[model samples]
Every structure is written in C-alpha cells, then in structure tokens.
Target: MELRQYLHAHGKDSIGIIGVSWAEDRFGDPSESRLQRIAAFIDPKIPVVRETDDLVKAFSPLEQVPANFVYNRSGKLIYGDGSPKLMTKKQLEGLLAGSK
Candidate 1:
C-alpha cells in the first residue's frame, strides 16, 4: 500500500505497474479467479500480464510467486527482489529518484 501511495504521489508519470502471473492451476482455482482475488486487494486499474511457462522462465530467475522487478525509463532493470515485502517505501523512493 505504501508503494501504491508513493507511486501515486510521485511516480505517476514515471512508473508503470504490471502484475505478472504464471497461471498455474496447482491451487485448484483458475488463474483468473486467483487474479481476481488479488485484484480485490489492489487498485483494479493496474494491468496484469499473464506469462506463459516459457515467458516466466525467460523473465525471471526465481520461478517463484510474487517476484518484483523495477525498470527505469530506459528499460534497464534497476531493481529486482524475490519478495515485494522486502522493499520498503524509502528504498523504492530512492530507487526511483536515483534512476532519474
């Protein structure tokens, strides 16, 4: 929530939010339903990108749920962490500020 608030206040034009899911049905619920449940917690306007098995493998090394990646204006991956919870508001703010 802090990330959302910080982005809304300072990075509105600079940051782009995208949610990626591998669409695994291991939980018995459909990926769409899982995404819907997730959407209930966040702003619905945020676009969710569904990645295929190959795409998921290509984009991230962890191959785990809830990976976060931050890219700068020039499309360079400046920050990546396995857990979004590990990143603090100030750290995100600093990353954005330093990227510029």
Candidate 2:
C-alpha cells in the first residue's frame, strides 16, 4: 500500500504529514493576489506550509530542498533525509509498533 493510504488506514490518528514550499523570489516578490492564486492551486488534502525564508537552517545548517522528516510522538525527529521519497508502510508500521 502507498504511504498516504497506509497512513489513512492505520496511523491517521498517530501521525501527521505536512508539505512545505520555499518562496523562490528570484525576479521579484509575487504580489498577494499571485500568492493567493498559487495557494488555491494546492490540493486541500495535503497540509502545506510556506516558508518565505530558510527555516530549515534553524534546525540544521543544510540548504536542501525536498527534504523528508518523520517525527516521533515526542516531537523528536526520528528520520530525516534530504530526499523526496517517503518511508515505506513497513517502516512506518515498525516505528508505530515500537512506540507502543
């Protein structure tokens, strides 16, 4: 099963997922209207957070996009990799099992 489906079926209450996007202001800062339009385009099912600046630097001095992180119940990062791939269902299940 895919990560999204597995989360919904098994870990919906125990896990949370959020997607983040950086504000790439190369040419110029996009107007509020443009930003709103972009936000509207995102899927409502996925919770997304937008960062105007590099907030990852505060956690770790690494400038990597498409980072994946999994935090335990205590809000401690248990898994972090600068890759777009998500944890497999088995891997997530193992973590959940260990927590209890």
Candidate 3:
C-alpha cells in the first residue's frame, strides 16, 4: 500500500500520511467518477486530497512538486523541503515526541 510505503509502516494515533494531488491544476476539477477511479488503487485507509481553494490556507505559497511537509500533531508545520523522503519515521517520531 502506498500508505505503508510512504510512512514506513508507522503513522497512526497521532501521525498519518496523506497524498495531495494537484492534477486539477492541469486536468481540471475532479469528478466523482474520476476520484473514484483514483481511489480504487489506493488503500481505503489513506486519503488523497484534490487541490481546491480550501487548500489555500495551508498550502498557499506552493512552490514545487514532489515536495514534503511534516506537521506536528498540533497541526504545526515542523519540517518542509523541496525534496521527497527527507525524514524517516523514527526521526519524526523522536522529534515530535520531544516537541510535546
């Protein structure tokens, strides 16, 4: 499952991983059928958020693709980078634990 691979099998209780898709930027708004098709391949426990105005507050200054954002359990942005696979689950768990 992409969810398992993305989080290295961690991420539960106070942690989770979600995929954000910007396909609408070029392909146009997502239809129910289109979202359903994409969801078919993903684990039902994981969510893929389609781009929308609702995202402006959290991801307004969007820069580049394949980006990574790590937010703490409090919904605070803790780490961000222009690259993917920046931090391991163990590292994140330790960091977040100390933050509390």
Query: Mind sharing the TM-score for model 2?
Result: 0.58
Greater-lDDT candidate between 1 and 2: 1
**Where does candidate 2 stray beyond 4 Å?**
23-45, 59-66
Error of model 2, residue 37, in angstroms: 13
| Total colliding residue pairs, candidate 1 | 0
* Cα-based lDDT at residue 96, candidate 3: 67
Largest TM-score belongs to which candidate?
1
| Per-model TM against the reference | 0.74, 0.58, 0.53
- Collision pairs in model 1: none
After best superposition, candidate 2 residue 63: deviation in angstroms? 6.7
Worst 10 residues of 3 by lDDT: 1-10
Could you give me the TM-score of model 3 versus the true structure? 0.53
- The number of clashing residue pairs in model 3 is 0
Write down the RMSD of candidate 2 (Cα, Å): 4.8
- lDDT scores for all predictions? 0.69, 0.58, 0.61
Per residue, candidate 3 scores C-alpha lDDT tens digits across 1-100 of 3334544455443556686775546556657666656555544565787777777456656555546677776888887744454565566666767777
Clashing pairs in 2: none
The reply for model 1, stretches above 4 Å from the true place, is 11-14, 26-28, 81-85
